[model samples]
Every structure is written in C-alpha cells, then in structure tokens.
Target: MESFNAGDVAEKIMAAIQKEYKELKTLNVMVLGKTGVGKSTLINNMFSEKLADTGIGKPVTDKIRKIEKPDFPLAIYDTPGLELGGQNVVNALLADVTEEIKKGISSGDIGKMIHCIWYCISTPSHRFEQTEVDFLKAFLNQTSLINVPVIVVLTQSYSKADARSLTAEIEKENLPIVKVVPVLAEDYEIDEEYVAKAFGLDTLSEIINNVIPEAVKKTFIAVQCANLEIKKRRAQAIVATAAITAAATGAIPIPFSDAALLVPEQITMIGSITAVFGIRLEKGTIYAILSATIGTAGTTILGRTVVSNLLKLIPVAGSVAGGIISGATAAALTAALGEAYITILARVVKGEMNVKDISTAKGKKEIARIFKDLLKIKRDNNGTAIESEIETSADNTNSFEIND
Candidate 1:
C-alpha cells in the first residue's frame, strides 16, 4: 500500500478552494468626487492597496473607469470629480453614468451593476460652495431616479467640529443621500507640530457593508481593509462551518485509510479564511505547510498510528475503536486548525510576523504547536473521552441490531 502524501492532498484541496473562490460574483462600487478630494487615496487606504498605482484599470466610459485587482472579487468604478461650475461637463458625466448603469441592469448582471456610490468632499474646505451643493443636489436627484444609493462622504476632516457641521448642513438640506459618513481615510502630517490621525474609516466601512446587498457581503468583507473585526467575524464563521462539517464527516464509519475524503472541506474552510484575510498562498507553499503540519504533529488528529494499531486487534474491537474517533474529535481538530491559522494570519497582517516565513520549517512548527494546544483545549472543554464515546456508540449500535 502506498503511503498517503499530505502535500498532494493539500494541493488538491487548495485547487478546489481557488476554483470556488473564482466563481463568486464580484462586488462593484462607484466613487465620485473632485480629483483632489483624495478618492484614490481613500480607496487605497480602505482596501489596503494603491489600486490606481497598479495601472490595470480600463476605461469603462469617457467619464468612468473600472479598477480591478487580479484574482480579487471587488471592482471600483471611478468617476472624475464633477466640475461644479461647468454645467455642460456635469451633464455629460451624468449622461455617461446613467447609460452605463442602465446597460448593466439591462444585461441582467446585477453583480456588474454599481451597488453603492460614495460622494466625497474634503473637510478642510470647511463648507460646501453653493455651486458644489447645487451640483450634489442635482446628482443625487438624478441618481435617485435610477434607484442607486448615494453616500455623502466628508473626507480629510482634521477636526470633529468641521465634520459635524458639514454633516449637519447636508442633513439639514434633506438631500436624497442614503448616509453621511465622515472619514479621515489616511493619517496626515501637518508639519513637525501636528499630525492628523486616521478615524471614521470603520464607520465608513460599516455604512458600505450595510448598504450593499447580502449576496456581495463576503466580497465586501474580504476586500475592505479598515475593519479587522469584520474579517475576524467572517473567519470565525468559517471556522464554525468547517467544525460542523468535520463533525458530520466523523459521524460516518470510514476507516482511517480513507480519511482523505475529509480533507476537501477543511481545505475549503482554510481557503475561505485566507481570502477573508487577503492572504494568497502559492501552490508549493501550501503543499509545504500541509506536509509540515502532518509531519510535525497531525498524527493525533489524523490517527495514522492509532488506526494501524487498532486494525491489528480483534475485528469487533478494532471497529469499535475506529468508531470512537467521532465527529466531536473532527470538529475539535478542525476548529483548532482554523483558529491557529487565523492567529498566524492576523499577526502577519499586523506586521508582527513575516509572511515569507509562513511556509518555512520553523513557522510550520509554531503553527503545529498552536494547533495542538488549541485542539487539546477544545477536547477538554467538550469533556468527552474519545474511547468512551466510541465504545458507547458502538455498543448501542450492536444492541439495536440484536433487538431488531
């Protein structure tokens, strides 16, 4: 019999996950503002990438362009800042936007349709000029006809007073805007004397999250960089789902030799968590991590030695022992693996850990250690001895069969 290569299994699982991720629909957002209102900067900060620097975007229309990151499921529709004084320019821009949105809607690709709009105004300006307000009012009214939600974003607000005043003014106007969000998208230095801190980014993210439809929430959670809590929540949810799946798989009476069938779900769960954290792993790196994990300490969960030894015992005893490795064990093991990976990724994101080291031997050992500790914790909390559970379940099954 050939020994199972954990690396090969890992590769297959990652490939399945990547394929599924690629099939998800993209989330489309449109950003509107004057050129200097820091639209590009806001986008870069919020998404953790300088998208405009990539130069990968193509012109969607004369006045609009779409910026997309490779292998990412979010796209930004960027519009040139409206010329407040130029009625003709504003009209032309509006015409183009309306046409593009209608085109997307007509094609029945709602995913391609712009789900939300961010109208940015710099806070340092202190107040909106009359022309700017007029322009915004007109734009909001026009877009409302198309049933698109518009969020008024006050950007670069160095002081709370200014942001509050601006928001109040907009609210007083009773414009058709869906929400008014004040955000300091990036930290700013104003000389040796003072530096402005980044704030309200999470609020902006929450607003966006609430506005977008449910279908694209995962994409939003994955793409936006402002809210670590959102990513953590999504990761935890993935772990929970994976744990449940592992438990379900454990309920089946598969021999240890056929345990490869349990791998795909775990892989998919890990892939989903990584996607949420914006970590992309190469195939070779993934294989190395999987091999290292199994080689280091995964034997406890995978039960290779135990299975082999149990198989040498009497048939009924061996079967009963095998049955003891139940769904609870699978759930505990999977949850531990997921949480360990999440911790590692969080550290990487926070600059405390090096991403390049993740596939290294030392890194894999640390991960394996964390996994084992977490697994032990989970098992202890559950308070079920593997042998006792399996024996009880097996005996119950036998008794039911005898009675029948």
Candidate 2:
C-alpha cells in the first residue's frame, strides 16, 4: 500500500521523456530544388524548428550540404547548387548526389542513410525543365537498388488549377516516383486583397509517413509538425497499448492503495506520446497534469479519497469492491488520463494554448474537465476508449512537371 506520490512520479516521467528523446533515431531527408523554389520555406514549416536557418550545416559534397541541429534527430541534405543549367551540370550534380547516396547506403546504419528524397519544383515556373527530368531518370536508374522513396513536391501551388495541371503532366512521365505532392507550405498573399491559405503540407506529411522506413517512422512522427492528425494517430496508438497494459496489471484486482503499480505503464505511455508531439514537458507541466487528472498532491492517485472521486466520475467502476480495483476500471482511468493529455498537447500544437500556461489554474481546471469527460466514456472489450473519430476531407492534390 505505497502512497502514489505526484512529485516522484513527475520525476520518473521526466526521465522517461529524456529516454524517449534519446532513443529516437535521426530521420534523414534530402531536399533537392533550385534556389527560390521555396525549399527554405518548406523546411521551416515542415518541422518544429526553423531548421533551415538554425541547423549547423557543412558541405557533404560540393553541391550537397548536410544540415542538422544539436540533439535534434533529423538531417536535411540540401542541394544549393542545383539548377537545370545544362546536361553537363545535371550529370555533375548527379554524380555528386549518387555518390553521397552510396556513401549513406554503405554506412550500414539506417539512421545514417537517406530515408527519403524530396524534389521540389516551383509551380510559378510553370514548366519543368528537361535537364531536371533527365537528372531524375538517371538518378533513379543508378539508385534503383537502394530503394529510397523520392517525392516530387510542387511548391507555391496557391493555384489549385495549376497544381492539377502540373500533376497530370508529372504523372504522364511514368517515373517510378512515390507521389508528386503539391504543397503551399504557408499562406501566400495572392495580392493585397487576398491571401491563399496554406494547404497540402498535411498531405505531404501523410505521404512521407506512409513511405519512410518503419524504424524511422517514430522519428518522423516526432520531428514533423506539418500534420497534427499524424501525431494524434500515433499518440492514440500508444495510449491504446498502454491502456491494455494497465488492464493486464490490474487483472488480479489490486488494492486501491497500491495502484501506483500502474505508474510505470502510464509513465511510458506519457513519455512516448510526448515524443510523438515533440513537445518537451517541464516538471511543473507534468505535475499539473497529474494533479488535475489523477489526483492532488495531498492524496495521490490511488488514495481512498482520490479513488472514490474517480469512481464518481467513472460510474462503471461500481464493480470495485472492498477497496480493490478491477482491470476494466484501471484501463478506463488510464485511457481517460491519456486522452486528456493529448487534448492539452493538441491545443498547444494549434497555438491555442501556451505551454508555460499549462501550470496555471485555468489550464488545470480545463485539464480536469477533459479528464472527467473522458472518464465517463465507455470502453471496448480491449480496454480502449470508445470514442468517435472526427474526419475531415482534404484534396491530396499531387502535381509533377514533365519538361521535355
């Protein structure tokens, strides 16, 4: 009957978070585009940080530069000298690029290898040059055995009609590329009177998620901030797994006071979800979450008073008998906590909530409200929360250019 201490649990969760971050392998993406194709804009918005500006880069080769940040698990290999100047330029750049790819392949470490390649084309240019097409063709044939996924990205595609036309043209080439995604990474002022809203980044993020190596999918999920839905899906999966684990841990009807036994599973779940969101949670933030959702500092989560409070929110916990907790009750509690945490994080991602304010009273009250609402929801047979997903429609318009 050990007391569940919020302070101790917060420390453990913090350590778990560090461990999760440290374990994430580096996700390497090569971005190929001529200058002013909005490659910098694309890189800046695709990730959590302004990586193109802040990342320390050095020449990987004459034309290629590798950009990476300290302690960040992503690398962007950029081609600053790339342009369809002529066949000679394309062949020289191609030799440098293929050699670099071969070096990555020979490294024998998946993390060091290029997981994906992005060929960016500026939509305003309207026509893809023959040199560019020839380069891709030769590069694909040379690296055919390596199997890295190459995606053609049409940048500044504020005009959907132009994007569609460009897409059709790229598709006509019948290149063995993954997808030609048209993306407007950020809003563009079509004129003083109107601004084109950002679109297709979420679609680009989803496409990359579908193609990257399984080993680096978690890394991609952690690094990319273009799609909130991608992060939500991965975080929800972690919650589902943790909920089932909690159910297993409580199979023998543990005494209410010893429910701290569930802490380990929940901590892992929290750490993993934090990684997926790529948000660093301060100790105060963790304490605020536990205090609001689990219990206060006076009576930690498993205390008789706290358990009773939880039971009040969760009417299905009527099966608890003589201070014993059932597997279902444990799972429900776990799921509610996780879902509430995700809500808070999603708000932060959307910029609706500030991270520093999470420890404020208003934030705590909001967290408590979410947790209670989730607690009242029914669970499925597998102990996962029974909730309906809200779906939204987006045109995943992918455009490629074919330049003769």
Candidate 3:
C-alpha cells in the first residue's frame, strides 16, 4: 500500500467513511439531450455492460435505466426524443424530467437524490435543432432540480482541435457548467481520468472529507475493513495448506514418476482456465487465441512440480497419494487465484481502482482534507458539447423563462 502511497488501516477507515457518506445514497443521473445523441451508449459504457442499447439509429432508450455502482445506486433517466415541431417538443421533454423526478420521489432515498446530470451531444457539426434548443430552455427554466452539476459529454470527437474549440464555446452559454468530458468512443479514448473529471472530484472528495455525517462514514469504513480481513484470512488458509503438505512430504520419499507427469498437465490446464476467466471464448479457445498461452502453460507445469515434491510423505504409491497432492495443491492455489482475480476484475469493470479503498489511513485523510480542491477538467471538442452550444441560442431567446 505504501508503494502506491496508499496508507494503513487508519487511512482506509477515514477514506471509506468519507466515500460512503458522500456516495452511498442512491443517485439519479439523467442523460438528457436530443434523440440519437449516444446517451444510452454512454451509460452502457459507464456500466461496462450492454445495460442500454446503442447504435446510429434514432434513440432507443425511451425508458429509464437504473444501475447500481460500488459506492451508490442510481437511475439514469433517458428522456424521450423531442419532436421536430417547437412547443410540443419542449412539453414532452419537460414532462419526462418532471415525471422522472416524481418517480424518484416515490422511490424514497434514491429517488430524492439527483446528484448529477449529463447532457450528451455529437460533435463537429455544432448545429442545434429547434427541438433541441427548446428542450434545454424548458429544462433550465422549469425544473426544480437546481444546484445539481451538469456535464456536457462530447461524443465522437476526432481531433484535439475539435475539443479545444468546443469547450470555449460551451462556457459562454451561461449554464452552471461542471465539466466537458470528451469521448471518442470509436477511437477508444474512453479513460477513467476523463470520466472522473466529469463527476466532480472536488465535490466528491469534499463529500469524502467533510459532507458525509461522521457516524455513517464509520459504518462504511467498518464494512470495508471487514472485507479486507476476509482477504487476509483466505491468504492464511493457503499458507497453512502449503505448510502441511510440505511437512507430510518431508516424512516420506515417494517416486515422482506418475505424479510428475500428471501434475504439470493439471496445473497447466487450471492456470490457463483461470487466466482467461472473463474471456468469452471456450477453455480450448483461450489457449489457441492468446499469445501468452505458452507462458501460462509453463507457469502451471512449474507450479504443479513444486507442489508434488512438497507432498511426498504418504507411504507407497496409491490413489490416496495422488488425491492428496492434487486436492491440496488445487484447493490452495485455486482459492488464492480466484480471490485475487475477482478483486482485479471488479476494478477493471468499474473503470478505476478504489483509490479511497486502497489509500493509507493518513493519505486517505489528506485526500479527504483536500476534497474541496479537486477540480473537473473539460475537453473542448466533443459531440455532446457541440449540441449543447448550438441549443444555447434558442435557450437565450427564451432566457427569461428558462433562467427564471
């Protein structure tokens, strides 16, 4: 933990408590924009699952998507597409937000918290339709969901220049701009740095440091501490298993001929399967598809050899000898490997490691202290930002009504 500057037990407690209080409650982040602006795709990517459908066609996310994250639960309401005609479109969009907000109220704690809103738009064209502009104006003017941060995610950005120009233009809209996160989904520029920036680290950190009630924070920290203890216990189990095997083998010397041959193949197969646990392909396919298959294969064979020799104490070669060697080795190693893999996979799936979870008690406290200092960075040239800007003019025309 120190190598990564993550602190000890105290730090984990501090960070965990802060994060829990600030983020534990259910949050609804509405993805609002014109039809076909990639809102569903954004949520799908955020969740790392096909929770919502996405394509070039017209908006398919007519309903809302409720997703649960590690820290909090949320419902991402994808509003209906606005009509090409003016007032009718405004009414429809307004109605949708209002209904969702009410629904949130009905849902109790999760419903009441609309922590953030993201308005997605496509880039380069930088054109706004009447429907789009009207919707933005109506949303700003009519909604009571104030103070909630609004981010403009520009989808489909190609060049750096596009991002730069768009960021500047968007700031001029008089909206309470939080950030402009750029996405080049087609180009694979989707990184945690940008998304975290969009989510307002300063605010989030503040919540970690100060906003959450102290009692709640303590409970959350306790849960994380419990989980960490479980990991430590599993590791101890593995060590004990290995030590017992070694002691048994030292008492007797059995021929390694049959055991040696079978052990490597078994280890190799297990290692290969474990290595490709999340992959979509079959077990055989992983071996054939991955270039590192040979390395994985070798690791398995070596691992088994080490275990077999260490298990030699039983008298005379028999099925029991093989069973003890195989069972103990596989059980110990498999449990260790499975736990480790799940921890890594969870982070990969969630888009970032829990820095707060991994932080030292002191460092986490410092991070909590500096929560207010964290800032969201904006990218200039995304598609979502362009649509937001284009819609600004119409919003301006109805300024008195929307901004009121």
Candidate number with greatest lDDT: 2
lDDT of 2 at 286: 93
Winning model by TM-score: 2
Question: Where is model 2 more than 4 Å wrong at Cα?
Answer: 252-261, 387-404
lDDT of 1 by residue, 62-109 (tens): 779899888778788898656554878877887787787777677888
Model 2 residue 266 distance off true place after TM-score fit, in angstroms:
0.8
Q: What lDDT score belongs to each candidate, Candidate 1 first? A: 0.69, 0.82, 0.38
lDDT by residue (115-223, candidate 3, tens digit) is 5566676666465444555566557554435444566677655545665677666655665555666665443334755431232222222332232233333222222
Task: Flag clash pairs in model 2.
Answer: 167-399
- Which window of ten consecutive residues has the lowest lDDT sum in model 3? 375-384
Residue-level error in angstroms, candidate 2, position 111: 0.8
Query: Residue 81 lDDT in model 2?
Result: 81
Between candidates 2 and 3, name the one with more favorable lDDT.
2
Question: What's the best-to-worst order under lDDT?
Answer: 2, 1, 3
Error of 1 at 250 (Å): 4.1
